[model samples]
Target: MEFSSWPQVPMINQKNYYTEFLKRDDQILALRLQQDERLNARKKAAVDIDRARAQAAQEGLPFLEPDPDLDEDEAMNDDDIDNYGSKTIVINVGSQNMRLGLATDALPKTVPMVIAKKAARSEAEDSEPRPKRVKLDEDAPSEEWFGEDFAREYNAMAQDFRTSRRGNKRRVLPNSRELVIKWNSTTPPERIPEHSDPLRIDWTELPANPAKAPDYIVGSAALRLPEKSKPRYQLYWPLRHGWLNEKEYDNRNMLERDFFLILEESIKNELGLTHKKDWNQYSCVFIVPDLYEKAFVTKVLDELIRDFGFQRVCFIQESLAATFGAGYGAACIIDMGAQKTSISCVEDGMVIEESRVNLKYGGYDVTETFAKMMLFDRLNYADFNLMRRHDFLLAEELKEGFTTMSDENITVQTYDFHLRASGQETRKYTFKIYDEGMLAPLGYFRPTIFDHSKKLIGRHKLIPRSVDLYNGHPNDPLSPAQLAVIAYVNQTIPSAVMPAPAKPARLMPTPMVSTPSKQRLLGLPAHLNGDKDATPLSSPAASPPAEDAGTPHPTGEDANGDEVGDLKGAQPDTEVMDRTVPIMPLEQAILTSIHHGSGADERRRREFMGSIMLIGGASKTPNLGPYLEMRLRAAVPQYPKEILVASPPRELDPAMLVWKGGSVFGKLRMTNDSWIGALEYDRLGARILNYKCLWHW
Candidate 1:
């Protein structure tokens, strides 16, 4: 059967089902055969032993008793058995691949990690050359396999043999003659296997010959393993959700559910340890979006703990994870993902909680807007039903051609309907739709300035009166509704942009008034503005200002006297007002988004500063690191020179940076224990609370 042609059959399930069944049946048959052979051998050995014992008894001499503890001593001499509970397995799961091995030792240094590259062919050479196939022994029987072909044929046949014999049935090939094979060319020079010993030949003819060997092998120069290396103490597990599972479902909750299921399956398959047995064996840390509530995470953890035997589960903030993974020294993470755009700030390894933000607009939203626009444009000539029919194809085309912010013209061929004057039947019409004024969705990230118009005088409190100016103007570029949408979208954009002071004027007097006191109490700079002086607000009070002033108060107000209505209360000291800003609950949601989004800026920041690591899948986006670096440079202009972003090696796992760092933390030889194991917590009970107090003391 042509399985590929059958769309109804899910490829993954079909492959797994057949493969697993065949493997099981093969194991059963092999086991049965082995058991029968072993039983016969045991019986023969028993007979020989009994005969020897009888001979001793008949000789009228008491048979000397063998050492009673011989079996115990033999068992002791065998390999030492380890407790299953103590064993640790490191499972590195990725979106496309999985790796599982023991955690006792670091990955083998000698193992080849080569990335295969396509051999480049010059355009001139490709155009000029045409190799003709040479006929060898044209008279030779075409059906018969040659001795030279035997090695190639046998290897292919052997693979087929193994595959075909996977089940209970087995078949043998008809031919059984050993043959030698060597590479041959019509030219004078010949090619042969380089090894001194010839590979054993087999009789069966293979279905296909292998490809020709390459002229050169490309790879890195081999290096020796380090002598005094630390043990492989970290275990990384990644899980991928196939697109097919949630392709039809647009519901976010349903998609998350599906993702969780796939993650569980991945963990089970890659770890070789079931959640039921091993979840409690080690600490499980989760880095997920804020949309997944703490209650939900707690519930999931509890279920895994109670039913699956998971003991300790830790929830790591996704943005923090991305920061750890990306190693973005001191920068913000701009994560553009399927559902949202997120921005997060990282300082060292910690995430700046207040600076994290999320924008609702994302790739999915852009796709949706594009679809609606296409529908609206087509409505001028075609029926809605017809448009819906072609919507999927249209979406696919847009997705393929769409660039972030390209200005290229896109034309799509679509069908339109027309009626003839003497119409007896409908006529099929073809039309080419030119997408006019279609800008790339990239503008969605920028600050939107729109004229607010169309207001029923004071109808809405939030709508300003000036918005009415653009009411009747058809060409007005700004749409208040769109602007509102943009604001809502901005809510979801991670808050990499710190809230600016309500009034910069208010802050001007702040430095002047506070400088003298800061100089006296905190030893701040005497000169309010000096080249060597750092921003007094950012520093701890004690740092002396680089410049010196003639008098503490330039305004001539007594140092002890209150200067009313002058520098005293002119600005309301709004810099202090930053503390009064209420925390947005939705801020958590944005933080979650940035955790999963990725860009180039985040990557560079991570690489350069080993202290800050980027974590989370979002931090893995292309160009995320660079974008973040640009934004950070713009946002925090004060520390332009001092600010440094880390640059990690390109080959490292950017998403797993935090997890790897966490694993490393677990192995640190610190005097103060950071982690509280489940057993200790359970045994101590309420006394665990006292542990925190003791630590502070």
Candidate 2:
């Protein structure tokens, strides 16, 4: 495979290409929305027709029955399919987002995995007088959880009433309040009332039954909650890193059912399949991480069959699907996603699972780091509690801006954080991002400077003591903490809390509350905390808090009442601490993944590493292909490795490469007899997936 022999690359400007991609994606999304509206209208019309027929029959007049072929007619109402080509709905659900639609299109419909809730309280319930400023007791479950530590000052927990059971609802609490209080630090809202924290929300009353609340809001709409209404609308991430959060969902025994409903709705509403009367009308190809256990896979398929009545369902490895999408026979894939970056070695379309490397850092970590950097150095704000979703989104914008820009020191972007205190005039703070600020996000590529290994703790240590490991369930094989640990170690924690690696890795120093210090990264200028010429301190840990308000100190002390120090004698390197984020450098992560499998043949390894396929939204950074090629070429041990990076055709989006590959795999021509039908699943069970899917030898 010579460079000249590779497929011709499409000539398109990166900016134009992505802009057009987003535009086309918006069009597809609009179609999906229309389909949902049409579905609702049809349902209402059907109900009305039934009622009219009954009334006419009672009046001793002729009654006309509704059309028997109404569903089929509505299903074919999609006139756009004729022009765009009908496609088998392909679905790829990641922790951060869900990609749905037919494979023949340029891009799949994307929806964020975030869910929001608005309690539909009756007028009577809303008029009920609220409890006045009640202080939470220390022992009243207020101090039981890490998030609960801030509960006393702000209402961390509140109840919302519902009078109906029609919409989505999940059991959150055991008491009569029946509130599903969700607190997400990942996408915190931009503003808060005088007495509230980011996670604080008031009880909402719904018109539905008092026993149930409204199901949560899903997709991008979740981000659009009014600033003032944030306290009333609870947001949750049903899927986190790659799987369901057991702590939040598993105990309810509704995890599988909820996932089924969510995916079903996504397929019908987001993919414009609302016309399909039943799941049997369409075959589904599900893409999941290779690390998923068989039991989980079977459970998923079982629900899809029993609940949704899908006629056919087949599961495939994400790496394999990505390889097929890239049109590569063998390649090492660097999937830079929202929460985790996975480096996988795929040879001839078969994934080498043992050689795969899962890093705890990804796009979200970059945004988080950049946000902290903005708060600590660029802006004068010191109260981290005031940091809102608006700030996080701005940080994300800056990161994307810098990644696309050519200049090193140029201004990336600017955003204003608006603050309005009690009885005070609204204040606006404008923050400008520079290329130096990009260093925080740049840590993902070169992580030595932002190593946060100290944050890695044994999984059992994350829980509050109040949670009983066992609640009198004698058949329980493992405690909740232990199950969480298993999920954590396997890189499946929904909240993206990565478990510690077996081997320790080195990282660069990121000190919080230390004296201003300048540090450079690979010739790039490092901006100290508002200091132009300060030198890196010999020990950032031993350095006292530079200023109380500006440079706030995180939990840096040990049980001995001394500052927590790292192996290198600096402040503990941990993501939990402010400004310090842990990430394995891209180069190291790739190389480590390449050499991980002892059984890998030299030729297979060489071919896989020789051509690297970069996919995912994070891989959209400008010049990434050339930069990686240069890095690979300059490596000391480079041999049989004229590294060539291949992205999706310029006309196609790198962010959609995986889903595209799934589209390719789902094609009837490509997989004529591979899918497991409902009958097969019923007879053979989950092992049917292993037998049907292309196995990694």
Task: Give the TM-score of each candidate.
Answer: 0.34, 0.55
lDDT of 1 at 666: 27
Model 1 deviation from the true structure expressed as Cα RMSD, one decimal place:
30.8
Model 1, TM vs. native = 0.34
Model 1 residue 324 CA deviation (Å) reads 2.9
Whole-model Cα lDDT per candidate? 0.32, 0.50
Cα lDDT of model 2 by residue, 400-425, tens digit: 76543123333334544555432333
Q: Candidate 2 — worst ten consecutive residues by lDDT sum? A: 472-481
Please give the RMSD to the true structure for each candidate, in Å. 30.8, 23.8
Candidate 2 segments exceeding 4 Å error: 1-87, 118-213, 247-254, 378-392, 403-407, 410-429, 446-583, 596-603, 637-641, 669-671
